[model samples]
Target: MVEKWLVALQVILAAIGVYQFTLSLFGIYRKKKHKEYEPKKTFAVLVAAHNEEAVIDALMENLKTVDYPKDMYDVFVICDNCTDNTADIVREHGWTACERHNPHQRGKGFAIEWMLKKLWEMPRQFDAVVMLDADNLVSPDFLREMNNDLCSGARVIQGYIDTKNPHDSWITAAYGVTYWYCNRLWQLSRTNLKMANFLGGTGMCFENQLLKDMGWGATSLVEDLEFTVRCVKNGVNPVFNYKARVYDEKPLTFKASARQRLRWMQGHFTVARRYFFPLLWQSLKERNLAKFDTALYTITVYTVLVTFLLTGYMWVDAALFNGPNFPTLYEYLPTWLAVVSVVATCAAFILALILEGVKSWRVYASLITFPIFLLSWWPITFYAFFTQNNKVWSHTEHTRVVRLDEVHGKQVS
Candidate 1:
């Protein structure tokens, strides 16, 4: 029984691995000739800040010089239960600032919903709305790229996240590589295949109507992800605009990374519970591959669970259950699939680093140890399973602010 079940598990793991690898490969070779579109849409850029005074000044400075028309967008900042000068700085700097004092209501989603409510009551109407974190600096062309997509009839969009402090530590280096890998492996790749891309909590844009229609109430820890799936269910597909970039801070310490990733893993499970079955049903009922793609995307963590369990089973089988006639686990793993699983993923990461033009020797040098960082997720996954039911939002501390010109030593478009 154990032997037979092990075979079944191996097949499932291989299938899931191949699916991800195939999508990544398609994303790598897939390129499109983008048609030029006018940047005519007006936007309200929303920033949710929680005691982010350390980095607020830098983001404000970056926003002031964004390469779009001055009147095309207005920056709105929300100081959610802030005990610091975050609200004061925004107000002092000649920008709109809203103070959120409700201790009962926390997290970015609730804060954003409150801000949207305030905006809905205002006299001005916006064509689109963009959400950002206070620890981020926008590329000069951030609004322009989003405007291009909005004009092209995209209702929701996500921008690329470039790490502002990649060389801060090895932890940060791993975080940077992961983002670069994901930009191509997931979002850019999904965009290439004409599928909806997931949203990074920061640097996401939605049509004002959609925002109002849903009341900006995706209050889960993974609000960006929850909202992305909600958009798909509502028949709205999000487009990825790689040219629109936002530089965000990464946690420089292992403890900080663990805290942040735990929140993410927990929130992912929260979202999967509510939407996974619906997505699967839609895919079967409508014969929609895209819906199925999103469904698979939601449950990919199961692959990790299976991977860990299979390793334990193989260990025991080899030691005690080996009948001498029993085949090794490696023999069961398909040769081509096994080779592609390891080779393709690493190759994709290398290609991403090259494409992103990261020149720091430290960033490249850390690639050798990046596997250790990736393996950290396995333990984090189990940690989340124990703590997922706890509903508390623990924000990662983000004081690091290495500006674009400082990191790359040149102007970035």
Candidate 2:
């Protein structure tokens, strides 16, 4: 009986690993065949910066180079309680700057809310509001592509955010590869399949009315995830635009990376607790079974991580403790097959990394150091699981000047 149960568990885990791997492969294929569309609308680009004096100037320069109508697109920077020259830098760029002094209501969510409220009261307006992080440098045609998607009736659109400084260190390189893989395979492919895609913190465009109706309530540390969930609950599916690219920096140090990821994990946990049940209820009430399944998967990160670990343990135990006298816990053949399935799943991850390297020359150098980048995540993941008290926002350190030419093969501007 115990042997039968072990076999069943191993088989189930193997199947899941195979399924995830297959999805990733299919995702990469779909990304290659993605098409681009242009929108006939304008955009209001809103940036929320907190002590980003170093990077704000470059961001403004990149914003100015965007391939959209100058009359149709305008930049708005909300310097959220910055004790730096961020506001002055924005003013120097001849852009609109809103200085917000909110000590209690910290985090990007609050910064976004304050900006949205201020924008809502303005007489002059845009068709859609594009939200970007202060550190991001968007591609020239970003606005054009997002506007195109919006014109095609997409209420929300998420753009591809690539890393700008992957060569900074091994940790950054690993993060860069992961980001590329997620965006190119997971997000773009899922979007093509008509599946829900979460809004990344930056490079997302929203219909003005949707923003107004949603009230821009920023509460979670991972505001983007919460916002995406909220939109889905209200019957809005975010569209993914592969042509819209925004390059941003990754944490250079392991400590910074861990801090950033902990915040994300914590925010995800918070969202799972607060919105999961309500969203599930809303899905059932609206008869949207598909949406419900997506929501469940979004909140199942912890489960997925736990299952992966359990699968590894079972494989090792089966290999070491197999004998006729002892009598194995699971069917030996299925257990071996399960081990093979796990290996195949790892192959899929490597394939995704190689494909990303092929897509961009800048990432190729970092790919050699990918293993080091991955191993560093284990400690961070372990810490996140135990440190349930990580609610306070830990800001990532971003230096003002970037080695753009060395990393991207050309100056950003």
Candidate 3:
């Protein structure tokens, strides 16, 4: 019975690993053709800020350099429960500043829903709405690429999330490497395979019609992910636009990054509970492969915990029931296979850096220790399982204030 159970568990882990590896391979060879569409869609760029006085000014100034037409997009900053001068800075840039003092509803989801209602109340109706963080610098061609996606019939689009402070610290470098890998492997692969792309909190855009139809009702800890699941269930999968880039400031310290990820893992648990079954049911009822894919993707965060527990149990079982005929747990997985897996994964990370045009030698060196960062997720996952019900929003503080020119040393067109 123990041997049989071990085989089943190994098969499950192998399947997950193989599925992800296949996707990464798909991402590597896929080349998407870019088409320029006439800028016809009016946009309401919404920036959610909570006392982001340090970075809001830089973001506001960066928006001024966006290559899109002045009349095409309007910027609005939502200063939620901010005692700082976040609102004042937005007004200084001649952008509309919306101040909300609701301590009860403090997360980005509530702020977004509130802002959507505010936008509807006004006379100006937008064709689409772009969501962004206060601690971000938009690429010059951000809106233009989004416009191309919208015009090309993508209802919900996610932009490539780049790190603004990749070299500031090892934590940020890990984040930079991770985001670059995901952009190519996860997001781009899903797009190439015609599957749904999950939305990062920032750098997402939704059509006004879809927003009105679905409404910004996601108030979970990771509203972006919850909303993505909702969109998938509704038969409206979000697509990835690689050209639409948004540079986000990463958490400088490991502790800050861990806390932020803890909240995210907690939110993942919440969303999985709420939508996993529904997504599965939808896929079965409609025979939709996309919905099924989304369902599978939803539970992937728990993969680390599941694999850990199963392997640990197998090891203990092997120790207790050792015999000459019974092979140890380590014997089940060939050493060469494990070595190849690690090498292939490291090669992929290096490929991501080259493709993303990251030149810093230090950033490349950080990849050697990136596995430590990935391993850190184990404890976070365990803790999140116990505290998943605690939905308190813990915001990561952003202090690196860099201009658009400073990000890439040249404007992104």
Candidate 4:
């Protein structure tokens, strides 16, 4: 009975993995419609920070260098629960600053909510709002690309994210690979299918009215995912803008990223509990594929959890008690089947890297260690089970202040 159950469970997990992978490949069929955009829409660029004095000036300077009229867009910084001079620097740079010191209410979500209310009360109105991380650097044409998409009837938009510190460590390089895979595999495919795109934590733009209508009070540790679930329910999906690039600082150490990943996993599960069944039920009733896809995406972490558990069980059961006398993975699943799974995964990574124009030896070399990075998610996900109610988060520190070209090893300009 144990052997039969293990085989059946493995089959189910295999099918789920294959389904998700195949679905991600829909980007290969995506058709792009391009147009020249007049940068007419005024923007309110928002930066959320806790203790980012080291990097705020660079972000502010980068914003000033954006290839758009200086008067057309205004920058706003929310210094939420900061002990450093993060707000003072924003003021020094002549940007709008909202300094919130409420010890009880923390996290980016609360900070954004407070700032939004304050902004709406002011006389000046922004056509759209773009949320950026305090540690991020933007492309010169980032706003222009967003304006084009906004004018073309996209109310929500997310930009492409590249690591500003990819070469700093193997961990950051692995993050680059993971994001490269995500950029095409997830966002592009969803756009091609006319489905909802997940709101990236940073580098996302939204029409002010859409945000107001949704009552944007997403306070989860993973506010982006929470906002995404709410947005999909209200029929507002983010559109992908590949040219609108945002350079984010990936965690260089495993400890920093592990905490971040666990928080993300916890938030994902929270959102899934709140939205998945409703989405699944709605899809069944209204026959909405978009909702179904979003639900499918949400539950994948759970599937991953099951896969890990079952793999461990099978390994132990085979080595200790099974009659097949230490059966190899190929004994449970056919050799050809295992080979196909690995080949498909490799093919996806190759396509993503090639499409993203990555030729770095560092990035290629890190691929050998990327599986270890992926494996770490298992433990992180396990910890996520106990952290569903975490309200506060530790901020990932960033101190890299070099020009984009320096970190990227090529002249970006």
Candidate 5:
């Protein structure tokens, strides 16, 4: 009976994995044919930077390249308690810069709220606000496309953010491939199907009114995800715009990646606990089927972690107790098939990297080591379970002076 149960569970898990894979492939297909939209109104580009002086120059240069009327659109950088020259760099570009020295409210959420309140107080304002990280570079037409989405009645628009340092190391390469696959396939398919998409940290646009009402009260680790969920529950479906591209630097070291991902995992777990019950109950009461889907996706983070643990336990049980005499169902299947599935997943990742036009052969070779990268997250996920030290806002250091020519052999300008 135990063997039968294990077999059933394994089969179900495998089927779900395959289904998600297929959905991702369909998303990639849809993304290829996505149309570009032009902006019909002015936008305010808000950047929250803390000690980002090294990269602020490139970011400012890219900001100037945005295809919009300079007099109409303005750039606002909120230097959140920075002891560095981040504020000075923004001011040097003749752009609007606000320096906040609040030691108590230190998170990005607080910085954004402070900026929004400041914008609201101004006599002249923008129709929409575009949020970006200090290390991010917007494409020349980013504002045009995002503005079009705003005119089309989309209160929230998410743009594609690709990594700029894929060739820095094996760790960065793996992250590049993962991000490329997700943006090109997973997000595209879900958006086409009218499903919800969580807001990425940057490359997102919001209506001025919405931000005014919400006040960025979600001062958590994954504030972007938390805020996105709040907007979805409030009847705002974020629209994904593949045409509006933003390039960001990836974490070049394992230590940096682990810290960043752990914070994300912890934040996700926190959100799951806080909103799952309330959202689930509200969805059922209102008979909102889409809300149900959002709730399921939000809850799946913890479920996937649990499933990984349970699967490992079953494998160990089969290996130790049911080896020869019991002949467990999983043991009957050819080991080569499991190996082949993993290889196929890697092949898909390689294909995605190639499709994104990555040129480094060494980076491509690092694709074989991708499994190691995936396994590195296990420790972080496990640690997140027992960790209640959510007070300290762990910030990832971004070194921006390194140009794309130095990393990838091509300069944007």
Candidate 6:
């Protein structure tokens, strides 16, 4: 009887996997009809920085070359509780430095809220606001692409996030591989399907009115995800712009990377618990597919944990007790079907690399060992589950600095 129940659970989990698999297929059709538009929107480009003296200058220099009207857009650096000369660097670059000295409320989310309130009080009005990290390098066409999206009626947009230092180290390359894979398979696919795209911490843009409507009150560790769920519940879907690209600096060491991912998981678990039921209820009330999809995404973070626990129980029952041998999902399903799933996964990974224009051999080799990185998340999810309420922010130090031209290996016009 226990074995039968276990088999049923596995079948249900496998069905969800199939749903995701079908969604990934849509990613392959990457072509979208993007309309060319004049730059009529004014932008307030906001960069959140904390003790980022090493890389802030490079980002400022990169922003100077953005292919948009200079008077139409302004850059503001939120120097959040910085002991270093982060604010000084921004002022040196002739951008506004909004120095936030609140040690109690110290996170990217808080800093952004503070800055947004200040921007609202100021005389200058903006059509949209773009959020970025201090270590990110934007493509020259980023603002132009964002302008196009705004002109075409997209209120919230997430730009493509690429790695700035993929070949810097094995750890960095693995991080690059994960982002590259997710950017295409997840973000692009959801865009093609007309599903909501979540706001990545950086490379996110929001219409000023939308931000004011939502109040920008997501002060969690993963404020981006929290705000995304809020947007979905309010019937606003965030769209993705593949042409608007921002290169972020990845952590160079495994220790740094683990700390970063652990914080992300902790925040993810928090958002799931807080909004999962509300989103489900909203979806049912409205009979909206987009809301249903967003609800599934909010709760799907735990599917891995549930799957791991079930598999472990099956193994222990088979080994210790006089029970049926641990039955694989494949045992209940067809052998050919399992083989096809494996083949499809490999093809998807290879397809991501090819479509993302990943030229670094080191990044490719590091991705070959990417399973170890995925496995590492199992322990993180377990730890984060227990400590979801611990909202203490863990800052991942970014020292790797690369210019916009260096990332593409050519002069970026």
Measured by lDDT, the strongest candidate is 3
Task: Give the clashing pairs for model 2.
Answer: 3-329, 38-148, 39-147, 39-148, 54-400
Instruction: For model 6, give the 10-residue run with minimal summed lDDT.
Output: 404-413
lDDT of 6 by residue, 1-413 (tens): 87677778788788888988888878877885689799899999999999999999999999999999999999999999899999999999999999999989889999999999999999989999999999999999999999999999999999999888877777777777777878899899999899999889999999999999879999999999999999999889999999899999988888888889889888888888899898998899888878887888876669877877876676787789965566667766678998898888777887888887766666667767777877777777777788878878998897877887688962121
- What lDDT score goes with residue 364 in model 5? 66
Query: After aligning candidate 3 to the native by TM-score, how far in Å is the CA of 307 from where it should be?
Result: 2.1
* Top TM-score hit: 6
Worst 10 residues of 1 by lDDT: 404-413
Q: What local lDDT score does residue 180 receive in model 2, on the 0 to 100 scale? A: 71
lDDT of the structure predicted as candidate 3: 0.87
State model 1's lDDT: 0.83
After best superposition, candidate 1 residue 235: deviation in angstroms? 1.3
lDDT of 1 by residue, 86-169 (tens): 988897777898999999978898999899999889888889999999999888888988988888889999999878877778
Worst 10 residues of 2 by lDDT: 323-332
List residue ranges in candidate 2 displaced over 4 A.
1-16, 31-39, 281-290, 308-336, 357-379, 403-407, 410-413
Model 4 segments more than 4 A misplaced: 1-11, 29-33, 322-333, 407-413
TM-score of 6: 0.95
Task: State the lDDT of candidate 5 residue by residue for 289-398, as single tens digits.
Answer: 65765676666566567666765676677799773443334486898978887777767777666666667676667768888888776667778877835745677889
lDDT by residue for model 4 over 1-413, one digit each (tens)?
66566667666677778777877888765455689678889999999998999989989888989999999999999988889999999999899878899988878888999989988897899999999999999999999999999999999899988778887888988888888889888888888878888888999999988887877779888898888877777777778887789999899899988988888888888887888999888877878878777887778778767777866766777788863443334675567978888888888987888777787877887789889998998878877877767766667888877565565562121
Candidate 5: 10-residue stretch with minimal lDDT = 404-413
Error of 3 at 137 (Å): 0.6
Residues 1-413, candidate 2: write the lDDT tens digits.
86566556556655555555555565766544434555468778999888998788888888887777788888999998889999889989889999999788788888898888889889987789999988888888898888777767899999987878766677776777788778766786677577678788999999998888887775688889888888888788888888788888888887787788878877777777778888888788887854675567556545545555555565666688652322333445666866776577556556666665544554556666776666555555556666646666677768836533444652121
Residue 358 lDDT, candidate 5, scale 0-100: 64
Evaluate candidate 5 by giving its C-alpha RMSD to the native, one decimal: 3.4
Sort by lDDT, best first.
3, 6, 4, 1, 5, 2
- Residue-level error in angstroms, candidate 2, position 67: 0.9
lDDT of all the models against the reference? Answer: 0.83, 0.75, 0.87, 0.83, 0.77, 0.87
